[model samples]
Target chain A: MKVQSVAVLWQIWSRKSFVTSSTLRAFSTSLINPSNSILMSPSLVSLDCPDTWTSGSVQSDRSSVQKYTSKHVAQILDGKVMAEEIRSGIALEVKRMKESIGQVPGLAVILVGQQRDSLTYVRNKKIGSEEVGIKFLMTMLPDNCTENEVCKALQSYSENPSVHGIILQLPLPRHLDEGKILGLLTLDKDVDGFHPVNIGNLAMLGREPLFIPCTPKGCIELLLRSGIDIKGKKAVVIGRSNIVGLPMSLLLQRHHATVTIIHAYTKNPDKVAHEADILITAAGVPNLVCRNWLKPGAIVVDVGTTPVEDPECEHGYRLIGDVCFEEASKVASAVTPVPGGVGPMTVAMLLHNTLESAKRAFKFS
Target chain B: MKVQSVAVLWQIWSRKSFVTSSTLRAFSTSLINPSNSILMSPSLVSLDCPDTWTSGSVQSDRSSVQKYTSKHVAQILDGKVMAEEIRSGIALEVKRMKESIGQVPGLAVILVGQQRDSLTYVRNKKIGSEEVGIKFLMTMLPDNCTENEVCKALQSYSENPSVHGIILQLPLPRHLDEGKILGLLTLDKDVDGFHPVNIGNLAMLGREPLFIPCTPKGCIELLLRSGIDIKGKKAVVIGRSNIVGLPMSLLLQRHHATVTIIHAYTKNPDKVAHEADILITAAGVPNLVCRNWLKPGAIVVDVGTTPVEDPECEHGYRLIGDVCFEEASKVASAVTPVPGGVGPMTVAMLLHNTLESAKRAFKFS
Candidate 1:
């Protein structure tokens, strides 16, 4: 059987056709025995195929029917491509706003302590914001910066006429209280959407947050732009953290999907996971979800990016997502790759949120 | 089969023994056919049974064995009793505060427009507050009051030195945006916990809201006071309203329960409800959940108080909860009765929150 368009793939995924039932039964068996759940080899599901997509344990999307020696693979939910598309649109908007308002949107980031990951995130945010013509400002404080200093920094950014959005990078020194510092950001300037008020609005049905957390917003954007309908679908989110998991689940629910959160205390996580039509994993545990944990033709979003030590790689470490991509590719109809997946989208979304905050602040609309 | 002692009943609820496995299988059949879910003759699962305390459902407490009935029943999670107990403690604290500080805790309520239910609630709140020696100050506005008028009233209450807690009654006139007026309430004076900041705090894991929404807080109080272990339990909240369902689900999740919310758009809600170990319904749909919708021995908290027209009842209407009480009693291990259940606890919780706000404001221990 050859499948060409995503619409067809969605049909197969939603219908759970006879062709995929055997593969599903096998995957179901793995759920019953979680120890054997992981598939040894990872397969990259490429949507860049116009070929015979035959049903088999080891399938490929190569154009030649004769090359179909393997099982059915997943279609890649290319976040990089989507992020680039969004960034382009945001850039156009930024240009329009600059022309009308005589100033570009500005985003301020306050980073305390020198954590490698935090530095990388701030750098990416800066690059992404500049790419979209947003004025990027960074406030770096010493490792031993007092709580008053951090609060003062936030207060300055919040009051700055040019700064439309403010973000305080996470994982401050152990002694510093993140909540107290985050609370210091004015709700209007809280571009990261980490403030309780912003999050609270997101959780409420009738209310809308000025900004949604970048990563989750990016995940939902990918799904929406891909023509995936969230309403009435069983969307299972793995993890319950405020940043990604909790808000993502709430967003999906707001879109009319039935959401179930599988957390640390959840019993029979694998079995519960198999029931989801759309599965999103944000639990930073690398390779925690195996191929069998997903229902056949399920759409998977891997938000986890945990760096595991690997001397063979240039960085001496490789970032792995929560899901085992290879095995998952064979089972899930669509899946996101770690580095190119949620990572780029998250940065793009941060700029998008900043732009939005700027538009509201300047009344550019 | 007569069983004595709540310990024996708890064992039956938790163990899923041979007797209940068969019972569960029979009830599980109702999922495929919701029309047949409600049993014709509902049996109340009572704890008032007599017999030597046995391991089975029929075993009764030795002291109460003589009062045992043939049919299995649920133990009532009496909210009235619990709320009264909480109020007594709060009252003592109020009296102590009056003695020490020469003034009792003060709660100011601002009510706009005259809705019958809203007036009733306000009156009840005043009586409850005064009964506990709390200074009750209420600001009543006309039905045609402007949004500014409402905000000005809230401002007055916020500025009142004696008023430690301020509540703006909800469902203001349709012309007025409740969000705008609600935003005016100071976070410290937001005793209702409807402020975005407070709700946001509640949604966060490490941070606690200054005040939890009265209704949901009361529900959690009932569960905790009843000794029901919330950890690792499968909790299903039926509704996503900001007031009750949303916060209740968050509270349950915070307690380490794997939580799922079933809303109006949810497909196969009955199937989802059947999976819950603890079910909380805030759907406001009268008799929406039937006996078959529950897993045998599950605990239920019904937050709905819909006034349905009933000619047989005085006032030409009767209050009904989301759960079909008579039907639910047969399946649930324990269930709160509608009238005396979450209703009274809600009021008590409002005062409890007010007391807490006062304690914080006055530096009372």
Candidate 2:
């Protein structure tokens, strides 16, 4: 058997002091226990081969000639590459729709505050929409904007004939009522899928929601595209946030996966997590999931993207996932990396939802 | 330690063949492992003492002089008694409101198709309402009634000032669109809490629903009244029907329990069920949950009520719970029985929700 040794180092930065520490880890590509490889299906292996042991290390020179053998190394579920492929396919469909009917999908966003992360998210969404040939529009409001102002903006987008999908960027000012504001968005144009009706439909059996929340949808897409069978699988989702964790569990259950949700108040979380065949962590706590939290040969999807300040990085901060990537590779059969994994897929799913809304509105199938 | 042995025989009747086989089992009242008693809080023990080893056997003579002893005998979570206490409280409040304000809470039901089970449920609701001083009204329609007739009935109740709450009996005729008809119900009058908006609110965090579904609410009431702590507990809910299981799981999560939902496609369900500190079975399959499926000292809430035909019974049938009561009594710390357990609690909760709706309508604090 041909063995490949990959040495990777991750710099852990403390949130308070900005102090960093690095640790080196290596795993082999060889399958140590063939019987333990539950997700090593032919279709998964084909997509897994290209980015199998790619490291998210900031320094490229960390890879060395030293050979370190381990039982198994996880196949990387590369959302960046998958997202690009989906975007390209969507772009072609958008072009064809434009040529045939002279109409393109339009997505409008209501950005409440000028939070740095929210701005970056809105920019990425705009770029992703443009990449797919979808028209993008935004209504910018100040942090001190009243509820009426936000409602007016939502009403405008809702009534606009060209606008197919509308989203209100979250984490509004403390003065504003988030639930009341979100409830005002028209159900037809709610591409973000935060509306109560959409959530209810998603949770219920024999009912379909107009849209599924983007981040969870992206995670499921990554799994399906990689040919992982969700039916009859034991799935554990950490965190129960409405945006990601709650909908993610509901979606997994819809796919016939027995799902357990672990929240902050949950006791013995690791014990619960270790029983999962498929584990999705969106707790937003850096390095919350360790090697012991995962079952051997379990597929892991990390949705957490906590920002830690790092002086060595160009962006002044590094994105850390809930799972310890260096540790997870040795235990998990497959894992998704932060920054390049669920993040890119969330943007891609948003574009997909927007396109779907437009198609539904136009009765274009 | 003083130990008490109780021999109980349950006649298991198969649905296809009503051939009954009686099995005699016995359990001790003594605490076998003191350290394993997680729910042995003082408040819980008090409620556990009364009706601790009561049996639901149809034959009274089966409680014989068999001295077979086991680790424990589960405390009966008597919903019938608890529901009566709640109804008395509601009755007092209703009497006060009627005397002082010259108004009383009114609940209207639209019953389409005289399905035997539905008719029995509706009749029980009416009797329960009258007992609690709540005005009850019903609209009867034929089995082949049109959707428009149902819609008209719903509209009349929705517009009526006297009717504070309206419930359209579930399992409507085959031809009528359930979702569409449910959508027509006024949000304020959705006392049954089947509306998508209410369900969505229940599923979401930091949002309150107008009404919670009766059965699940009743189950939680049972736990709380028994002084069982739900927070930080491992809960497993079997079956995911929109009515009982889904909302039950969601409600458990709201109380901060680490919840796992097991549906038909779930693999190794007993393994998952064995880990729960709180196990609620709503699978509707008689005796689906066995002794091995439960964790030691786990509180079992059996929501299943599958009616089995019997020639000896007064009603020509007997209701069987999801858990095998004889087996569960030996392993579980506490368990709810069918027919007299969650059944009466459902009616109590329905009246509670109706009174609340009236209170909100009248702006009475």
- The model with the greatest DockQ is 2
Candidate 2, residues B215-293: lDDT per residue as tens digits? 8888898898888998778899987878888888988888778899977766667778888889998876678788889
Candidate 2 stretches greater than 4 Å from native: A1-71, B1-71
Q: What is the TM-score of chain A, computed separately for every candidate?
A: 0.80, 0.81
What TM-score is obtained for chain B in each of the predicted models? Answer: 0.80, 0.81
Docking outcome class, model 2 = acceptable
In candidate 1, what are the lDDT values of residues A1-365, reduced to their tens digit? 00001111111112222223434444455457554322211111111111111112112122221122258888899876666656666676787788887989999989998976677667767766776689999999989999999999988988898999898877789889887778778989888788888888888766778788877888888887677887778899988777888888878877777898877767667777887889998777778788668888788998877776789965566677888999888888889987677776777677778887888888876
* Model 2 TM-score, all chains together: 0.82
Task: Give the alpha-carbon lDDT of every model.
Answer: 0.72, 0.74
Q: Residue by residue across B1-365, what tens digits does model 1's lDDT show?
A: 00001111111112222223433443454445454321121111121111111112211112211222337588899876666556656676787788988877899988888876677667777777877788999999999989888888888888888998998877778999987778788999887788877778787767778888878888888887788988668899987777888888887877777788887666677888888889998876677788768988789998877766779864465677778999888788899987778777777777888887788888977
